[model samples]
Target chain A: MALDFTIIGYIAGTLTTFASLPQLIKSLKTKDMKGISPYFVMSFTTGLFLWLIYGLFRNDYPIIIFNIISLMFWIPLLYLSLMDNLKNKIKINIK
Target chain B: MALDFTIIGYIAGTLTTFASLPQLIKSLKTKDMKGISPYFVMSFTTGLFLWLIYGLFRNDYPIIIFNIISLMFWIPLLYLSLMDNLKNKIKINIK
Candidate 1:
């Protein structure tokens, strides 16, 4: 039963960690980020960073590993979203 | 020290759980989900559901509570995105 729960945790972690991947790929391909909120990207990345710290303090490998992976995806997403938003603002200003 | 770590955990959980809010609000206001990936929504929601189950099995209140809240935000987002996507497809078909 404990093993089963552990398996569930790992699976859940994997799913959540990679969840942002599709968005990242799609955003890169389409270059359309009008719908991706910059606030969401910022808060999520900050949360993941905190989770990594929490995991380190707790000495929980799963939390640390999964949050680390989540950060990898989210950080790049955050950067892209911010840059996109910046470009939009600049375009509007020029107009 | 332990209490500090617990605080970090809660803070992390809070940020992550509410991370989707801005996106949800933006999508609703703009009716623009073109940048939001359907795959991301589906996988993230599924992962949150699994995390809730894992929390139940492990008797982790924070995990259970946070994931439940996250689901509240995500499920609606998923529904809205799907509906928007369907509308777009229908429009394209008619064209």
Candidate 2:
């Protein structure tokens, strides 16, 4: 319950938030999601959203703030990945 | 602050942890990490470790437990990704 430890949690959450940015840039730049797993994307996005809700319930500012920001980073990637998956599926069907 | 809310946090944590497993299974089965971003994996793994530490500092069992378990899931993917990236680098150097 020390204030210092909560600071550490904030830092950890920040790193987790930062870590996803590069991947987002990569996804946006390449527009390639073949290597991206949709199931994970869907699950991760949903889970983070749930975390945001959990944060709201607990009034945990760090959790709410980080999860929402993380969701912002993730949503586009999820959209792109789903689009790619759908396109690939269509291609396979056509062939 | 409420017990029910903490339970929700636990569920969120579990889902976040679970989200990575399918990705791990795919990585193991296909041995393809092209879509897997190493930056995220390393940062996430380190962040989770920090979260574990944060948990210890706060004496919060859930934070410690989920992060350690999440580490177990992420480490292999990180190793595989670094290996794949290294292989590609070596291939480029040879060519």
Candidate 3:
């Protein structure tokens, strides 16, 4: 039963962690942050961070592993968002 | 103990379900699907669909509720992606 639980959790984590790839690719290819909300990413990342801490405290490797991967996925998005802001700033300044 | 588990699950679900808001807003505002990867959303939605099923089998209301809300979040994304495709098709057809 415990093994079943672990298997379930593992499968769930794997699929979700992998799911971020499409968005990551999209962001990378277009380099356009206009349609992606910074706030959503911000809140989601914050939520994931807390979940990571929870998983750590519980010694839940699956949760930790998944969130870590998610972190990798989100960090670039936030960075891209920042870059977009910078570009906009430059554009406005030029104007 | 069950109460505690329920509380934990609810908190987790609430935060996650709510996290989709920013992305929805961003998508609505920019109407630009270029930066968002359709494949990622597709896979993620598929994963969520399975999770919802699992939750249903387990009678896990939290999971069911969260995924249903997530469905709400993702459906729009998929729709937006389709619209973007349609627009592109029109553009190509015009050319």
Candidate 4:
């Protein structure tokens, strides 16, 4: 039963951790991120960073591992979203 | 030291869990979910549900509480995104 729960926890962690990936892929392919909210990415990435620190302090392997992976995906997404937002602002200013 | 880590964990959990909220509010205000990926929501929600179950099995209160709140936000976001996607498809079909 304990092992079963561990399996479930890992699966859950995997799903949530990779959740941002599809959006990242879509944004990369289209180079269009008009609909993605910059605030969302910023908040999430910050959260993930803190989670990593928390995991380290607590010595929680699952939290540490998954959040590291989550950060890998989200940091890029956050960068893209910020860049896209900046581009849009510049375009608006130029116009 | 342990208490400090607990504080960090809660803060991290709160930030990550509520990360989707800004997007949800944006979508609600503008009714524009075009940038929001349906796949992301679907995957994230599934992960949250599983996490909730995992929390229950592990008797982890923080996990259960945060995931439940995350679901409250995400489920609505998921519904809106699906509805928007459907509307877009219908519009395309009519054209």
- The candidate maximizing DockQ is 1
Model 2 DockQ class: medium
Query: Scored by Cα lDDT, where does model 4 land?
Result: 0.88
What are the per-residue Cα lDDT tens digits for candidate 1 across B5-84?
99999999999888879988988889888888889988989999999999999999999999998998998899988898
Runs in model 1 lying further than 4 Å from the true structure: none
Isolated chain A TM-score, each model = 0.93, 0.94, 0.81, 0.92
Candidate 1, residue A27: Cα displacement in angstroms equals 1.0
Off by over 4 Å in 2: none
| Between candidates 3 and 4, the lDDT winner | 4
Candidate 4 pairs with clashing backbones: none
lDDT by residue (B3-91, candidate 4, tens digit) is: 99999988998888887788778777877777777898899999999999999998999999999999998998899989999999999
Runs in model 3 lying further than 4 Å from the true structure: A1-9, A93-95, B1-12
Backbone steric clashes in candidate 4, count: 0
Q: Against the hidden true structure, what lDDT does model 1 obtain?
A: 0.90
- Per lDDT, what order, best first? 1, 4, 2, 3
Q: What's every prediction's RMSD, in angstroms? A: 1.4, 1.7, 3.3, 1.6
Question: Each candidate: what lDDT?
Answer: 0.90, 0.86, 0.77, 0.88
Model 3 gets an lDDT of 0.77
- What's the lDDT for residue A83 in model 2? 94
lDDT tens readout by residue for model 4, A13-77: 89988887887787778776766668888998999999999999888998899999998888888
